[model samples]
Target: MTLVPPVTAAFTLEQSCFGKLRHSIRAFAGSFRPPQALSLRTAAHPSTSSVIVGFEASTWLRSPINALHSIPGRHVTIAFRTEVSDDGELSAWDVQSRKGQYDKVLNALWEMDLRELRVLRIDGLRWWGDQKQLFQERAYPFPPTQDDEAPLFARAWNVEVLILTARSDVSLLEALTELPAARNKLLFPRLHTIAMEWPRHESVSRSIVVDLFQKRHAAGLPVRTFQVLRKGGQDERWEDLLGFTQVVVHDSASE
Candidate 1:
């Protein structure tokens, strides 16, 4: 579905006593604004239509339930970003903190009302830390294992598009390999599109990419579109890739 440009609204106060009062009111109202990175849109008409919500930088800090409650729609696409430090080095504490924050958001998502959400796009996740240590320490933020049944974003039956963008191929591999043992039973049953992004220069072998989709298919996910996005490169031949009927490669100069 085509997404409309995000709509923004603003209010200004005049330079007068009443304006000062209005300014105060606005300030008070602003305090109640949705948490950072959360954006909601309601339909202009009364018809039962879809809505779109966007969460940008550092979305894991806030709960999305409250913002979602105010909107009504049959189909919703939640676009969000997870930001990690881009610095060259990271402490163990930094990794742990990132994991904790991500888990918090994951748990919140699992508990949220997803009766209308149809798509979830993690537009981008920046990880500048030690990749090996990150995965070794914690599970990927979605589809909590049977050990933790409550944080199940992957189990949401309504979700169709699951787009995950990572900073590197290792990060993507870590996410896929860290899935629970009973992954097939705990997978995205209704997911139709699985898109992943990473740098082109990252040393991701074709086998790794192929194996990821193979695992998804083995898990009973009827994913129809398999997309790969890289910073710069011609589309690679993915005809040999199993699982998805369509494989798309995208190159972005500015990625």
Candidate 2:
């Protein structure tokens, strides 16, 4: 289910009847949790257009795909966060380490046409090599294409906005904030707005942030707007970003 499902949906979390009968038989790192309740909630609410899951998210990956499938006309916001350790390690929720255990789940992500998505958001989740390899493998029989190496959202050409919430040591900065290797290798080609919710003051360097914008401008693919989200009222920080694009501040308290 997506987009603020009904209150009744919470009841299924406790004792879903589906859990009693439909438990996954496959061996998991620890134990498997039945995901049937996810499908049931979606079935109950037909108007759902957004889906966000946190705990036991891997078990629920199939629910959205089962509904949307290969259709690209309808757009939805899908956010799922699995458990990742503070030291770049994965918890039992990690699906990629299981080999072919979740091939269908990975396929569900690849099969969906990502071009229709308008906003792509990334937090502190460490994708390791999984995200990169996803596109790399798709380039089979074509020598390595740009899609094979570009960051995940870079391939979704239609995306207009990118939101990032990252820490200093997160791999996302290493993967996304860096300048493109080639002059023609522009990232987030159609993105006009970039929002950074600085989780900590020391999270990312201002020079690194400004350099990315400057590089993009030189390549003729400049982002038009940059937003910084702060906890309380608006505060003056990284104002130098104004040199490259219109700077906007968001007061998270009021929101």
Candidate 3:
């Protein structure tokens, strides 16, 4: 009703629009405030309390393992997987490359401080290339070599749980039996659980399992649980023969 200058009228309208816009923005932002109960729930969850670091062979070269040192956690498990072939066969050149990769990973682990490492699991393709098939074709036994760095790394870290799974022409049983007596007696001294996954077609005798446990005991390794997991059916007969209270057979299909 009062006469006002044209500029004053326009400025008042602009200021009113800006004020409304700011108020709306503030209300929208406030709506997103997280509930206090959600924060408490996240703090209490078990999975949230632990940290896991995983590595794949393809990406391992690009990433630095030392970055794990900065993560905060009371427990940590390092899981690594290596794939050797596009078709499950390693060529002559591939063998050298694979060995180099393995050595690099071993060296990294050895150099790192792993006081919080609770478990280590590695799954990979056969390391032996076509040598096993070649030996069988020529009617000769394939000689297996023990991994020197693996035991030393496990012993140094004092890993509590260890799991190894690889599909190769070489039998895991044979490799375990072939472990040098000197190293076998000292490897995995703090290991509480050991799990091995052999190929589905492989057949391991009950005596081999018993011998493995006996060797571990002799080595002063405090192993309390031993598990052999395979992908097929299970036979309860081994339970009676194993005689060890900690031995258990798991069928991977069911679990």
Candidate 4:
């Protein structure tokens, strides 16, 4: 039997009102708003298939909030920037602040009633901090503790494909581990494909992709598929991607 392609759609929201944006998208696609909770089976329409969301610009704190939670959809993808500055110099406040933001988003998504979730993607990240001056930095850093990234999507209805790109920090490797839950858990127990792309030589990224696969397999979530794509910022295949996905990546290079 030919596998049916899942229904997919993309979403982009501004930074200022991402909180509301999250609720809006969920209400629109999910068939219920924040103040309400509905079963995915009941909410899904005859036309409902699969949807994918992408954030082109950096929402910073807002990005995590929008992504951490699992929506009652077919698929979801989240991407962010990852470029660390002064490798060894990192700070405590930076780590905590970034983790805190992600925590907020995850906490919210965790509260939803997701049922048909399939694919999940987190990408375009940059890590910049100094170990010696971690606390003195004004901007918060990301990929907090390797432990913090795992709890975001412990239960994703029926996720099948997973993808990660441009992640300079290895902390996300933990994202693959399924959080043990009560019986009849709706988590991604049948995930099939996993894809991740990072800067070629960044040991952090290399170690992460390796560890992610190993750990998930050890945990009985053996990955059935895998793909790695190098992210080269704008020079990367933005146009090719647009053509491939039939979604315009926008010609901003000249602007």
Candidate 5:
């Protein structure tokens, strides 16, 4: 009989048992390998954040993760959800808190302590402060703001994969245009992949936005593979429109 270390046994069994039960088990195990002594292409940094609701990270912790004013030299994906606020309409207090969040994330990234940082998936971005009559009382919709754009632009210009959920806003591009590096037309210079999720919109026409993106992409920008997954049945045109950036759009519904 052979004896096995509890930790290794647990891990191996978990891998086996879950591998048969779950599709993501293999990837999850793969990510468990020890982090290497980062070998970066350029002197850059990257961190990845998930944009899912409960996973939204507070900006206060950026420094500890980013290692204080020193940019990571390799591909560092700074992961963050594009949506900062739960409800889009920022009350006076919400705005203050949001600003504080922005300051924390940007100050850390702006230190240029990273080689590359990418903004990952943002799903379920509702219209800023729109009203929907649910039961009786009126409620405020979530508002996406300009302040949230700095860290994103900083990462996009410097990182590898920028993944966003379908509900993300077009305003992200506006914010990119204002970045000091991007203003000089260097936003996403190092970007290789953009994973997007396109939400359905009845009133909004996305062609205008897609056209603008293509023009910029041709001008030496960082957009590489653009992929979109449509979840909510808002429209099918989004898939075609997303192609302007040469992005592949997948139908989440089919998956």
Candidate 6:
């Protein structure tokens, strides 16, 4: 799995994007771009067994995402970065534009089969538009159609690892904890591990983390581990993350 680099940028398959996905020791990292185009409409990839199981794009788009989803059963991870992407950097202009673009990508993701998706990593809370709206999908409810799978934007039921390397903000955390239609609905039913690195946020506190775990535990959800990343920033509940999950402070240095 380590060898399979995350498809990033214009969903580019390049070495630099690998650096973005492959967490390095000692320091930190940035975003990525696309290389040569690799169309999937004609046929499956040359070797689709496990070439890429993840996506790491800053501003996610629908076309490339659709192309990626065309290949069946290999979708394992999907990431959203804060920086400008190769797809359409103009969306960074304002909140309304970002909201529209982000909304479209979420709709595209909704249509895909994401059962095998294990890891969901999101970077930069800045990209999140209209803090209250879940991808501006208030009117658009869960599962689009009765037969459609539950949208990840609404609830990533099978996601095991939830990674939040975003900036110091609670918006992303709050959004991840619930959905637009089901605000009270707990997210990621199978989520067992949470790795976060948004430290010293005025809004983020020990109670927030505790509340997250408590709510999930009360619902019979398994929040077995909490990985506090100290690479960029730190959370206040360093030593306090004990009851529901093992309080493991993860450092930036490589293992």
**Best prediction by lDDT:** 6
TM-score of each prediction: 0.46, 0.50, 0.42, 0.43, 0.41, 0.52
Instruction: Please give the distance, in angstroms, between residue 231's alpha carbon in candidate 3 and its true position after superposition.
Output: 3.3
Clashing residue pair totals per candidate (backbone < 3 A) = 0, 2, 0, 34, 38, 1
Poorly placed runs, candidate 4 (over 4 Å): 1-15, 18-22, 29-113, 124-152, 178-187, 198-201, 230-255
Error of 5 at 255 (Å): 6.9
Error of 2 at 44 (Å): 27
Candidate order by lDDT, highest to lowest? 6, 1, 2, 4, 3, 5
Candidate 1's displacement at residue 32, Å, is 18
Decoy 4 TM-score against native = 0.43
**Cα displacement (Å) at residue 79, model 3:** 11
Highest TM-score: which candidate? Answer: 6
Return whichever of 4 and 6 wins on lDDT.
Answer: 6
Compared with the true structure, what per-residue lDDT tens digits does model 2 show for residues 1-255? 223434323311222221221111111111232111111011111111112222222222222222211211222223222223366565565434332222223323332334444554443232344434332234232224454534334445565665554321223433343443332445557767766654446535566667767766766778888767665454656656656788766556445
**Best-to-worst TM-score order:** 6, 2, 1, 4, 3, 5
What digit string (tens of lDDT, one per residue) describes model 4 on residues 1-255? 322235444343222112432453453334242212121110112111122332221221122222323333332322221222255454886555544444333323333434544545543222322211111111223333333332324435465655443332345444344343222332467766554443445555545655655666666666555443434453333232221122112222223
13, model 6: CA deviation in Å? 7.8
| Superposition-based RMSD of candidate 1 using all C-alpha atoms, in angstroms | 13.3
Question: Number of clashing pairs, model 4?
Answer: 34
Sequence-dependent TM-score of model 1: 0.46
Better of 1 and 3 by lDDT: 1
lDDT of 1 by residue, 1-255 (tens): 332334342222222211122233222212332112222211112111111343232232132222222221222233223334578465898667655544333333323444434555442233332222222222454444455423233334455555543422434443443453334443346656655654344565566767766766666654677666654555467776744547766665464
- lDDT (Cα atoms) of all candidates against the true structure: 0.40, 0.40, 0.35, 0.36, 0.34, 0.41
Instruction: Residues 1-255, candidate 6: write the lDDT tens digits.
Output: 133434432232322222333332101111122211111110112211112233332221112222211322223323322223455435536445444434433333333334444554443333333233332234453335542433334544566665554332444555445544434556667778776653546554656877777667666885888766554544445444456677666554533
Lowest-scoring 10 consecutive residues by lDDT in candidate 3? 35-44
The number of residue pairs in model 3 that clash at the backbone is 0
Pairs with steric clashes in candidate 1: none
Worst 10-residue lDDT window, candidate 6: 35-44
